[model samples]
Each structure stands twice: as C-alpha cells, then as structure tokens.
Target: MTRPDVTLENYDDVYRFYLDHQQNRLLARAAYAALSARFRPRVRYADGARDRLRELLSSDTRLIVVANHLSDRDQYTLAATAWRTPLRRAVGRTRVLAKDELFVDPGLRRKIDMMGSIPVFRSKNHGLRAVADAGRRMMDVSAQRLHRGDVLAIFPEGTCNEGDPTRVQRINTGVGHIAVKARKLGTAPALLAIGISYGPDRSADVHVAAPVLELPGTPMDVTRLVTAELQGAVDHAVAAR
Candidate 1:
C-alpha cells in the first residue's frame, strides 16, 4: 500500500514510523564522519567539558545536547564532533532533531532518516491546536528518547540564526518542557550546551559548553539555565574567531 501523505497536522504518525524503523547505526556513523570531515569543523572543548563527558559516559548517563543553530550543516558538524571525541562511544544511540519540512523531500528525507533523525513540527508554522498537539508530542518523544538512554541533540532555537552570529536567538520552551517532563519522570538526562560559528570560508569553530550539572524545578528555570549557558558558549566561540 502506498503511504499516505504527511502534513503538519498528521506528521506525528510519520515520526512514529521512523522512530520504530530507526536507521542503520554503522551507516549513519560512517556517513556522519565523512560529511563532518568534509565540512572541516574544529571542535573546541571547554575547560573540563571532556572530562565531564567522559564521566557521564563512564556512568552510562544519557545526554540531551542543546545548541545554537548556525547552518543547515550544523547536524553534520556536531555528529563529526561527537564521532571524534569521547562521545564517540555514544554515537550509536544518538539522535538529532530535524525539522519536519526536511522529511517532506524524497531524496533529502532518505539521507536525513539514515542519519538517525527524529522529526519535529514547529508550532510557529501552523495553527494553534495542531501546533500545540505536535509540540506536546515532540516533547514527549524527546523525553521518551532520554528515558531510553539515547543521546538527543537539539537546536532549542528551532532554526538557524540569520540576524547575529554571536547572539543566540530567542529559544523556544521545548527544551525547558523536556526538562520539566524529565523531572516528573525521575530520569532527567544530562543537559549539554554547544555553540558553533561558521566563518566566511565555511570553516566551523564548535564550542562545547560545560553541561548543566543540575536541573531546576520549573520549565522557565531550565530555560534560563540553558539560555545563559548557550549564550556564553556562543560569545566565547565568536570571540575566539
């Protein structure tokens, strides 16, 4: 049977299918490494970030990596960074959140799906009820992934920043919502912040902010903490350029 067309209103079903039929890990890793290397990102680890990551890995803690989106290739950059660092051990279980529109293109969707991408429909693109429903499912799926011990790398800003490279755009509350959900679930994932800067030549400087060691009670609390951390990482990375 031919699959039904997926729209913003019903993309959740499509996402569920992909989640169940996850991509091949070996293929995903190999492709990620090749793409990231071609993009040629220089990853800079903040003081103790590496050690902290290793510690988290040693204890088998799942990670929720948040970052400022710079370009369409940000996913590849972060994938390459993880593949090159101690986080390499966790690549097999890592999943990146990709906007739903990317999944609508046949050729691109194939590639995106193979990269262990989870589909996300942004509320900003739709009416209130549909967006609200999709947004809730997105957060629930994110929290579920964390509960399953998968590494989830997300762009909390939900899109690339076109205005100012050094300044982070207004973040959506999804990250905070995910954190709050985790709080209630009693299994909060380790929150990691990242900042990436692209030069005129397309070379990237990626910075890893120190992970938030603790989560606050409210969604706004989590939002403030992650926002401040990401902003700092962005500024530090841009200043280094």
Candidate 2:
C-alpha cells in the first residue's frame, strides 16, 4: 500500500497540536534531560571540537546544521553532544528538518516537536506540488528564523544510512532552496555541515567534526560544498575503524 500524501498544512497542524500539549512538552524535556545525562560519559569530541564549535555557534548568525544520519539514537546523541557546547542555546529555539513519519506516534511526536523539529515529507511517489508545498512551508519559517538569527538543523541524508559504510546518499536540494530564499529575504543563514558517526558498540561516543563551511554563498554551491565536507568527515571516521 502506498503511504498517504503529506502536505505542508498537515505538518503545521500536527506541529501546532503537539506544541499546544503542555503536559507532553514537560514530560519530553524531562525524558531528554535524563537520557542525555545517562549517556554523557560515553560521548567524546575530537581535539579542538569544542572550541571550533563554539566559534561557529557563538555568532548571532542563522545556521543550518547538516549532519549524516545513522540511527534513531543518533538524533539524541547529536542533541546531547551539541548541548554540551554553546550549541545548546539554540535548543527549543532552533528548527530541525526531520522526516514526516516521526509524527505518527503521539509520544515521540510530541517529544521531537517540543525540540523544535519541522517534518519534511519524503514520499518518492508523491506529486511535485506536495513536495513543493512542504518546501515552501520550511522556507517561510526558516527565512523568518534566519532573519531573527535563529539556528536550524537538518540531516541532509533525509534518513539514516545504517548499513552503508562506503558512500553517502545524494542529498535533496531543498536545503539549497531554503538558503536561497533566506538570502533573497536578506537573511541568509550560514550553512554548517556536521558529520556524526557512532563509536564502538554504539556506546554513545559520537565523533563530531567541525563546521565545513561558514561563509555565506549561493544555495546550490553551499549545499554541494557542505555535502562534500560532511561526506569526507564520515569517510575519515570510517577509515579510522
């Protein structure tokens, strides 16, 4: 059976509903804090990781953090590790471009939404209009956030490449679209490519590479460069294995 078509309206409605649920928000934050603390010790950063990240995140500049996806647990690890540095200030305030399927579960949905995740539909069979609408929604808000100097994080791979060790998948160009729109609005956010790789036994030792690109540039150029850098980081991490 084919999945139902998802539109930008669906995303807005669900996100607003989740946000209105205060109890869920409170519980989710508590859960996130607990999980982060539990796995804190196992998390490790490369030399100069903290300083480099701080320098990148310290700016009032708008940002889009594009990282490689690995597993469901990877999001939490990324969030937790990021929280350890100045990046935590962007939490709850920043937007995360995520998959639409995550909204299916009330609990998980609430948690992620509370964390400022914006769902992006990834249906291969879906019409172009639907995809465009979703992109428009993201652009509208993302541009505003950029104008306001807020950060936004996105996983350019769209989904986890769990078993693939040799290659990174082709990235959707929507990130480029968002950047272009934001720039046109006179608020182009800096695109930061981040590579996240799991450690031995997935024990929470996440290797976070520094920002690959920081200067403002054209959307397509930024997208291509960021993807290349992120892929290179993943390759290096894998090679060390």
Give each model a TM-score.
0.92, 0.78
Clashes in each model (backbone N, CA, C under 3 Å)? 0, 0
Candidate 2 wrong stretches, greater than 4 Å: 1-32, 41-49, 125-129, 212-216, 239-241
lDDT of 2 by residue, 55-119 (tens): 76676667777777877876777677666656766665667777777767777765776776666
Instruction: List the pairs of residues colliding in candidate 2.
Output: none
The local distance difference test score of each candidate is: 0.79, 0.64
> Could you give candidate 1's per-residue lDDT for residues 61-140 as a string of tens digits?
87888888888878878887787777787766777888888878888887877877877877667766777877787788
- The whole-model C-alpha lDDT of candidate 1 against the native structure comes to 0.79
How big is the positional error of residue 184 in model 1, measured in Å on the Cα after superposition?
Answer: 2.2
